[model samples]
Target: MAQERDVNPWVKMGLELGPVIAFFIGYNRWKDDVFTIAGTDYNGFVLVTAAFIPLMVASTLILWRLSGHLSRMQILTLVLVLVFGGLTVWLNDETFFKMKPTIIYAMFAAILGFGLMRGQSYMAALMGQVMPMQPEGWMILTRRMTWFFAALAVANEAIWRLMSTDAWVNFKTFGLPLALFAFFMLQGGLVRRFGLDNGKG
Candidate 1:
């Protein structure tokens, strides 16, 4: 097993969220710059999408260097960002970038849901080493997360498709994080009720 490095919670949060924040800043700063790439006229959204890809890669690398390991979810997220972000920049179309979050959420939901169907708890498999829990707790958490991720996917689709670019960007930058914080807060009761003593279950 890889040695687990102790990371400050604030630092972890910063590493995870910094790239998106950077993208938002970069977009707002260059939204009107008449930039052209690959024979396509680029707008704020396209430029931000382009910037996001490299920032995500650099962030993931920093995370791995600091923690000595990258979680599966992190790896999956970076891959999707690169692929979808690349498409968005290359095509100079914002649709691909807008769909990235929905794709990611749906993929996670599907993975967990499939594991549950197979009588396995992927939540435990992914996080169990760090957070040991009873089988029941893992099952409950996995089921909850599967549904939560599905809901997020639907929400992302609705927002990007129905809202303007600025609204969609705001949702991505602020709304998603708030929603996740609320979701985790709501899970506190379940965690307390099911958490094992001695950090092992």
Candidate 2:
């Protein structure tokens, strides 16, 4: 297997986040436009979703090409983007796109839950390369992450179902990422205590 290169953090962040930011920009720029296809009218949301899909695909491919590897989460996220984004465009319904995040989070939660049942920390398996820690720490963090993903799934469902599309877009773009950042920041103590070598890089 080819060894993966250590990607620059800024470049990595850009590749991961560029598509999402583009989607937001595209949606806002053309949200008032109407697209007609096959004698059917599609809203700007659908149009932006179609555009978003390709951006996601391109970003994922570029990330893999640069880093020489794709994490399981990245692969899964790309697959879901293609599947749900394609469905949204094909069916001209935004519901599929809206539900994509929920499904992704829920699936991750389920996978982690299964790992926990088997006395394994799939969270560590997924993240161990960057954050080396004791086995006990991995297990504890894994348990918390499983619940966190579940909560995120629930939050996505609630936001999409009860809020406006604009609101949902904002939540997906900003709220979700912020929540994740906060969650990880809160884990600083765990990263300190159970971290190998006292969390030294």
Candidate 3:
């Protein structure tokens, strides 16, 4: 089990990011073998799908065993995995794996927007364990994240649909984390300006 102190943020990020990496690697390395997993005459998509499912399942299991239960982010992430992951298998399409992040982003955008519309800051609830902040701070941070996630969703769709697969792969592996880290850095500065808990927040 992962305690608060035991969980390295970057390692947490990696565990969460692993499936995407696995999909890219598997799809590229075993493109032919991917479809051949169930039988020799399977669709090319099935090969990738077969590889994608097991990695995602293992990742989720490890996460559950470590986190012990679903956190909001875990719940949100798992829903996308199960849905897109299933689509990958059922439709035998590798594109489903590639485009899964868009769904994840869209779900988050909607959820955060809903929280804002309801006069609550649910994003704050999700992150509160790792970072403590005042109620006012939470509200402000929530508002910031609401748009950030919404914009990310739009960007994800554009990136995957319009861009080449190699470009999308590079973006997923390198681009998204940089964007997230930059956004958080900017958010941290704003939170500091608002005097959120400097030590704990």
Candidate 4:
């Protein structure tokens, strides 16, 4: 089994990011095209959801092959995508797909919150290898992340309900990822402050 470190980070990123990119492209390309099946008309969102499910499955498989295994969070995400995406296509309703992100974010927030209640940091369990830190740091970061995820869940719910489909697609494809990146960037000070090597000198 190849160690995760042996794999390029960019390749891992592509595996995760490719499906979202394809969903965005697929929706835009077919947004105006309607598919009629069994006397039901389906829109671009349904079309993209149908295509995205297989793409997600393929990407998850590739990531597992490269990393040797998938984390619990990764597995959860794949399952949710399949479940929600399938519902969207099968029922010919876009609401299921729209609710998927809110469900995912809420679940993560709940998971982290449960861990925190038990005095454990599930975030550390998931991210410790990538960011070694003191237990104190992990706890603090986890607490913040739990709340952050909750906020994201609320934001996603608001966005999809209040905005147009195109706007939601853009937010999901670009805005959400960028927001997460910015959130991590903002935590640089915390990372340095409670890093495991802080007092080694």
lDDT of 4 by residue, 1-201 (tens): 545535578998999999999999999999999988788899888988998999999999988887787888789889999999999998888998999889999998999999999999998888898889998999999999999999999998999999999999999999999999999999999999999778831
Q: How do these models rank on lDDT, best leading?
A: 2, 4, 1, 3
What are the lDDT scores of the predictions, listed in order? 0.86, 0.93, 0.71, 0.91
TM-score of 2: 0.95
**Where does model 2 exceed 4 Å of error?**
199-201
Supply the global lDDT for candidate 4.
0.91
lDDT of 3 by residue, 126-154 (tens): 77666767777888888787778778778
**Per-residue C-alpha lDDT of model 1 across residues 96-186, encoded as one tens digit per residue:** 9899999999999999999999999988987787766788888998999999999999999998998887788888999999998998899
RMSD of each: 2.2, 1.9, 3.5, 1.8
Which pairs, if any, clash in model 4? none
TM-score for each predicted model, relative to the true structure: 0.91, 0.95, 0.78, 0.93
Q: Pick the winner on lDDT between candidates 2 and 4.
A: 2
Which scores better on TM-score, 1 or 4?
4
Between the candidate structures 2 and 3, which one is better when assessed by lDDT? 2
Positional deviation of residue 115's Cα in model 3 after best superposition, in angstroms: 1.7
Candidate 2 global lDDT: 0.93
How many clashing pairs does model 3 include?
2
